[model samples]
Target: MFILTLSETECRKMLADNRLARLACAKGKQPYVVPIYYAYAGDHLYAFSLPGRKIEWMRENPLVSVLVEECGHGEEWRSVIVDGRFEELPDRIGHKRERDRAWSLLSRHADWWEPGDLKPVTPPLSKYEPEVFFRISIDRLSGRAAKAA
Candidate 1:
């Protein structure tokens, strides 16, 4: 596979198109990776989740690695990897706002918000009161783009 550096515009495009990312966090020697839905605003990545296993793990360890990638037909692909620290936002109102923002992003890409039964059954913030929202402050960001030869 060939690799080329992605420009800022390219990086933003990739971020805008891909709504799902894999977040990798480690505590001590063990590492954990989980798929998350994220939204990019300015220079930060935001994601929301209810208090769960991942939230507990992140509370114990804040450092993380996130990967967002897109692969199309003919092997054309792009990916961005971010290494940084994650801060969990505890404000309930703020968490709700960010959760709405993330859902908006998903609605744009997928049919999750479509006008039908296929749409999300319950209100986005109903079950998750003590929601966990995080902002990833990117310490290092790198990307690659490649096309099939």
Candidate 2:
């Protein structure tokens, strides 16, 4: 098998083709990662979620990373990593346009509200969790692919 580096175009294509990714964020010295669904447009990865630990942590630290991977039969696989900054699109006058754009992008897929809008099976604190729309402005993107010789 051979492992090769993917070009920027390939990396972006992977991002565009995939919706699910592993989002990683840090707070002080602690690091947290979670699976999230996103939409790739321009230079950002737009996503939605409810108020939770990941959201709180990301608000404190906007620096984040995302990993998207595709695995095929046998030893074929491709993975892309994105280093980015987080920006929130709140439901307010100033962000109405951005929020609408995010909604439009996210709604393209079936059941796009899922996981993000689903209430926790067991309430963490029995508090209302509001939906959040945000985007990860990609700073750098890198990828690798492995295929049989």
Candidate 3:
């Protein structure tokens, strides 16, 4: 098999094409990862979630990473890793424009609100749990593609 590094343009193209990624964040020595749907725009990834563990951890430490991957037939695969900082868009006057932008970008997908909108049945959350809109400002992008030799 052969593994090749993807260029900046290739990496960005992949990000733009994909909708789901594994979002990772760290607090002190502990790291957390979860699957999230996002919209790629300019140099940031816009996503939505409830006030949960990831939201809390990211607020405490803005540094985060995302992994997007695609697998094809016969051992062909590609993956990208993004290192970024998270910035929340609250429901306020100052962030209205950005919040709208996030909505507009994400709304293009048919099921954009799935999983994020889902709530746990047993461990019920508060009815007042606020929806969170945030962006991961991309700092770096690295990717690799593997193909059968």
List, residue by residue over 93-139, the lDDT tens digit for candidate 2: 99899889999999999988777777656745477767999999999
> What is candidate 1's lDDT per residue for 42-133, written digit by digit as tens?
67777767666567777898888999988867878889998888877666675666556655654554543322122234665354345455
C-alpha lDDT values of all predictions: 0.72, 0.93, 0.95
Sorted by TM-score, highest first, which candidate order results? 3, 2, 1
The number of residue pairs in model 2 that clash at the backbone is 0
Candidates 1 and 2 compared by TM-score, better number: 2
Task: In angstroms, give how far residue 115 of model 2 lies from its true place.
Answer: 1.6
Best by TM-score: 3
- Report how far residue 92 has shifted in candidate 3, in Å: 0.5
State which candidate, 1 or 2, has the greater lDDT.
2
TM-score (C-alpha) between model 1 and the true structure? 0.72
lDDT of 3 by residue, 1-149 (tens): 99999999999999999999999999999999999999999999999998888999999999999999999889999999999999999999999999999999999999897667776767776478879999999999999999999
Compared with the true structure, the alpha-carbon lDDT of candidate 1 equals 0.72
